[model samples]
Target: WRRKNENNNDDPDPIPCIALALALLYYFRLPTNEDNVQRNDRSTPSREEFGDVLSKYIPGFVEIIQNELEQFVNTDHFVIPHG
Candidate 1:
């Protein structure tokens, strides 16, 4: 499904859509102050805790990144045209 972007009148890109989906997942996982209050665990998640949670959700994320990197390297001429 594609939605028109209000700013450019173009269909939304998949990259940003994926990023937004991941952001939503992280936002829910990392609870807010109100959520902490309800759970009665005031201490926030540590760096390791955050990494563990992210790793759980995105097991294939690293593979995806590696594949993209490989594709980029295989390209003969990697260049972005200036607008």
Candidate 2:
């Protein structure tokens, strides 16, 4: 999910987010821009087309992130010191 900061600006600029996402797709060796080729025989997938591809992996990604957060919270590093 793309998030906006308090001021309504993209917290992490969209370009890098898109680049990293594409890189992950490539790194995982999944069907990258080929998804578009299958759908429309295009070299580049439209945002919606690429999004459809990424959506499939979102659940697993979110679970990994959630688990990381859970583990982090359970560790002593999460403690806040008070006077």
TM-score list, all predictions? 0.34, 0.26
lDDT of each: 0.53, 0.50
The whole-model C-alpha lDDT of candidate 1 against the native structure comes to 0.53
C-alpha RMSD by candidate, in order:
12.5, 13.9
Candidate 1 Cα misplacement greater than 4 A, ranges: 11-16, 46-83
Instruction: Return the lDDT, model 1, position 51.
Output: 42
- Give the TM-score (vs. native) of candidate 2: 0.26
Off by over 4 Å in 2: 1-59, 80-83
Q: Kindly list the per-residue Cα lDDT of model 1 for residues 1-83, writing each as its tens digit.
A: 34445577766645434534554476346765666677888588633455456556665443433444565545464765556
